[model samples]
Target: MPRRSYDHYCAASRALDVIGDRWSLLVVRELLSGPRRYSDLFADLPGISTDVLATRLKDLERDGILTRHRIGPRATSAYELTVDGAALRPVLDALSAWGTPALGERRPTDAVRAHWLALPLGRAIGEQIDKGTVTVRIGETVFHVVVDGAEITHQDGPAPGPAIDLVLDLATANAVANGTLALADAGPDAQWSS
Candidate 1:
């Protein structure tokens, strides 16, 4: 089947023509952290069907947003963002900021993943510190974010070396993501380990 397009000459429309499909941008979001195996993407995306995921991967590759390469000792095929795809960071940031307000409360039916909070929380931390690694523990979910000047990168699990470790509950983490409470103002209860 041919990919759909708005057939408009505008830049936004042209850009959307490549990334407007369902699950397309989400795939980009998953790859933003780093390379991921097919199984990893499938597992992280709670509701995506296998067929849909495969097609989106192909589409993104065709659009030059991502590339598939062999990685690790086993040479497992992994998908990673290209330079062009990495350029989508600001786009995702804008969307995350705009959508934060709509995240008023967590619905019981809404699936939650700790790493999903990385982008927003990382951005919040970026505001305070110019550079450093921060390991955030939300309940049992552990993820570490590296802030380098204006760039932020995160991965699941704790930081390998010394870092400013922060332990926060879901509510406080949510408030930080929502911009209602700054990480600096997280009160004394928010544990810190250096």
Candidate 2:
């Protein structure tokens, strides 16, 4: 199907012409962590239908926001952000900041994923530390975030080498993510161990 457009000449409209679809940005969000297999994306996105996921992936690829490549010993195909897609980090950050207040309460129907906290929490951590890895444990979920200068990246498991281990409950984690509480100001709520 031909993609739709706003038919406007403005730059913002032009950008939106490529990404205004419902699931496009969310797909970009998932890929920001790194490459992911189709099954991984499907599993992480709770409510997306397989058909919709496939369509969004194709659309993103067609628009140059992402690319599909082979990786690992089995040469599994994975989707990863292109430079253009990674550029969406600030956009996501802006949205996260703007939407934080809307996240006042977690509805029972809201789907929760620990890795979803990586972006905001990583942003907060990046502000306080210049370099090093921090392994964050929230409940049973474990993920490690690497802060390098102004860039932050994360993966779904613990860091391979030595890292600062920090643990938080969901409430504290949410506060960190929403900017209500800085990671540094998390105080006693943040349990840190070398």
Candidate 3:
């Protein structure tokens, strides 16, 4: 692929030049948490073909959005967002907020991932506290989110030591994301330990 372009002299066009491909932003979304093995990205990204995923990774690396590096003796490779890529947080936030209204009710065929709620939920949690680790559990999936100053990051599983713990389901998570519900008022089923 020669790489597609809008061929216009606009800032949006310039942005599209870097991330206009089908799975580009979603690839960025998966990487927002931290570095991920290619297999991890493939697994989280449900419907993407192997070829397309490989191509998106190459394109993002070529555009300086992310970098792939090998670690340890086994040389396990992982893809991580560059500074410029991590800066896409606000863009992703805006996009997530914009799309939240349309996420009304999960259909029978919908596939859900707990960490998919990381960005919006992280933002929500960030607003509630200045700095702290929050462990979020949605069913069996567990992840810990760290909020340090203005930055928020999350990873798979729980945060070590004493931290605030939150448990909620997909419906409530959506409500929080959509601003229809407050975290403090997550009802009897939702529990939090500080």
Candidate 4:
């Protein structure tokens, strides 16, 4: 199916024409970390139908938001954001900040993924540090936030080298993300490792 557009001359409208779909930005969100296989994207995005996901990926690729490439010994296909697409980092950050307060509590119906908090939490941590790696552990899930100058990035798993280790529960993580709590206030309870 062809994309539906606002067809207006406005810049916002044109942008919307490209990324206005439901899963478009979310797909961008997942790709922000790094390249991911189709199955990886599907796994992280809970409710998206396979067909819808495929459509969004195709649209994004066509629009140059992301590109598909094959890698590894088996030549598995993966999708990654282009420079233009990565420019949406600030946009996603702003949206996450705006929406933080609305995330009061996790509802029973709400689906929670540990890695889903990576972006917002990384931003929270970014504000405190000049440059460092902070490994975060929330229950069984583990990930690291890397702060480089003004830019912050996170990976899905543990840090490779020595870094600060933050051991906290999901509640505290949400508090930090929503601005209710500061990283410094997380306290001596958190261990710092070499």
Candidate 5:
């Protein structure tokens, strides 16, 4: 094998090249929610035309960022993140943080983003549930936490009961977590709105 050069084989450099295009990472973002059909991906991405969606999906597949699989006995197909693809969570998180101020605020949907980072909220909440049952959703990730008298039992999936739904843009979420921005008021800069 030829020796890897910093410029040629740098992991970070190669990753940027693959995800440099705006849509590529967005596709990955959708996939983090789990397997999505081609149609669903297109639907989530409002403005991407069919041709563009097809091209981007194929491009991501080619780069091993995604894996396309046939689902159901009827052979419907869906796309999901590969092991390599899952590694992009940090990148996506970063993108979410960076893009929040510019791209997140204008959405008309009432979906609230509860942002938590100061504590292992998953664990903290797990310790607080009465008789051990509650529900929480953080982005695409969901889980059930069992409260065993101040002990935490962590499990994945939507928990049951009223969750303290905290919503914030990715940037706000990051700021709250990193202590750079307060959770009390995190929104897009007014200029981004107009």
Candidate 6:
């Protein structure tokens, strides 16, 4: 490949030099979710075409952004991140946070809220919460579940008092609260809970 020249001020241009195309960053997003097979990338990123996905994968491999693994024939294989590729998590998170507000003021930053809000809801919840208060715990973070009309959410910084309505597990909680998964799906009996 031949090298081209551009001005130093174009940070976007420099960034693009490494991850310029739409497919590249999307591919990185997919990889960030963990190791995934070709079909997995396809299943999650339905917008990409097969030929285009293939080309992007090869280019990433050539550039050392990722490395491919093989597993017999059924599904080709999966892609795992190299150090350089994995380094973009914060960038992805920041980018997500940046775009979420575009949905407007009343609307929340879907990603962050889900994560922070779900910080308290988890699988260990006893068969029935003995107290009326909603409970939430995400690592060291915590919140009490709150309900407003038909919608449920949370409030926090301290232990919740009685009369709240919703509680959740941080990771699984976010998956449920954010629309990635459903209440039925978050059930202790759900496949993910196991």
What is the lDDT, from 0 to 100, of the residue 71 in candidate 6?
Answer: 70
Q: Report the C-alpha lDDT of model 1 over 1-194, residue by residue, as the tens digit.
A: 79898999999999999999999998998888778899999998989999999999999999999999998899888999999999998899889989988888788998777677888999988887899999999988888889999888887789998999989888888888877888889887577789
Q: How many pairs of residues collide in model 4?
A: 0
User: How many clashes in each structure?
Assistant: 0, 0, 0, 0, 8, 9
Residue 184 of model 1 has an lDDT of 86
Collision pairs in model 3 = none
Query: Model 5, residue 133: what's the lDDT?
Result: 53
46-116: candidate 3 lDDT, tens digit per residue: 99999999999999999999999998799999999999999898788789878877877777887778788
**TM-score of model number 3:** 0.88
- Root mean square deviation (Cα) for candidate 3: 2.2
Q: Which is the winner by lDDT between candidate 3 and candidate 5? A: 3
lDDT of 4 by residue, 1-194 (tens): 77798989999899899889999999999988788999999998999999999999999999999999999999999999999899988888788878988988678888777777888889878887889999999888898889998888777678887888888787777677667778778665455566
For candidate 6, write residues 84-165 as lDDT tens digits. Answer: 8877755665565454335332334333333333312322222234334444545555455433332333344434344433
State the weakest 10-residue window (summed lDDT) of model 1: 184-193
Better of 5 and 6 by TM-score: 5
Judged by whole-model lDDT over C-alpha atoms, candidate 6 comes out at: 0.56
lDDT of 2 by residue, 1-194 (tens): 98899999899999998888988999998888778999999998999999999999999999999999998899888999999998998898778767877887778899988778888898888887899999999999888989989778887779988999989888899889977888988988798788
Worst 10 residues of 2 by lDDT: 96-105
Write down the lDDT of every candidate, Cα atoms only: 0.89, 0.88, 0.88, 0.86, 0.58, 0.56
